[model samples]
Target: MTMDELLHDPEFIELIKQYIDYLKSSVLEINTKLANGEYHDVMKFGHNIKGSGGGYGFMELTDLGKALEIAANDENKEECQKYLDLIEKFVQDKN
Candidate 1:
């Protein structure tokens, strides 16, 4: 289905809601992982979100996820935090 149609569909909307909720809950763990130098886990999480976000019609999330993934891959803590903050803000703005 087209993104517009998926956004209008109740089930798809619910699925998006669930995805956001999962992201919300993961924020803390992600932050903790970052603080601990667990870049691999963070990269994996980012990759998962990057893979799934656009499919759910949240291209912003996909973009942020890509940034996060790249930052994590580089092991750049500051850049990772920046993208993480953007992701959190995006989630807040969406809801």
Candidate 2:
């Protein structure tokens, strides 16, 4: 959806802010895990991100998170990093 269409709901926007905070925290945790080679935790984090992003109506983020989750599950570190970058870009552009 376009930014104008997505921004129409005040309540949703508020919820999105909260979710974005959660996303940021989760991203940090995931980064820490990845840094330590804790791949399973990273996968779990990506799964959480995917669910929460979809719940908050950030479909692009949701898709990116899903791809990350899948890549994590498959032990495809490069693809997972790509998806992570996509999600970061989406969040940065939106905010």
Candidate 3:
């Protein structure tokens, strides 16, 4: 469904915007942590993204985040990168 169809409530849109902003911030933070080899922080950030994305009706993002979380848990960098790429594409498409 289109976002407009999936989200009828204006308040929900506002919440979604907030969640997206948070997602963007978290992406930056997580990327920084990953660059520094702080894998634990990346996992925590992925968990946050999974929860918040689901709460905001961004199911695709939530699924990607969940995958990232799993990869992070396993310290599978390549798998996590795949999920992150999906998320970036999803967000870009939304815009």
Taking all chains together, the TM-score of candidate 2 against the true structure is: 0.78
Mind giving the per-residue lDDT tens digits that candidate 3 earns over 1-95?
Answer: 56677598787778777777766666767776766767787788778778877767777777787788888899887777777777767766766
Q: What's the residue-level lDDT of 47 in candidate 2?
A: 83
Please report the TM-score between candidate 3 and the true structure: 0.81
Q: Which ten residues in a row are the worst by lDDT in model 3?
A: 19-28
Number of backbone clashes in candidate 1:
0
On the 0 to 100 scale, the lDDT of residue 49 in model 3 is: 75
Stretches of candidate 3 exceeding 4 Å from the true structure: 1-6
The number of clashing residue pairs in each candidate reads 0, 0, 0
Every model's TM-score: 0.94, 0.78, 0.81
Q: What is the C-alpha RMSD of each candidate to the true structure, in Å?
A: 0.9, 3.1, 2.9
Residues forming the 10-long window of minimal summed lDDT in candidate 2: 86-95
Candidates 1 and 2 compared: the better one by lDDT is: 1
**Collision pairs in model 2:** none
| Leading candidate by TM-score | 1
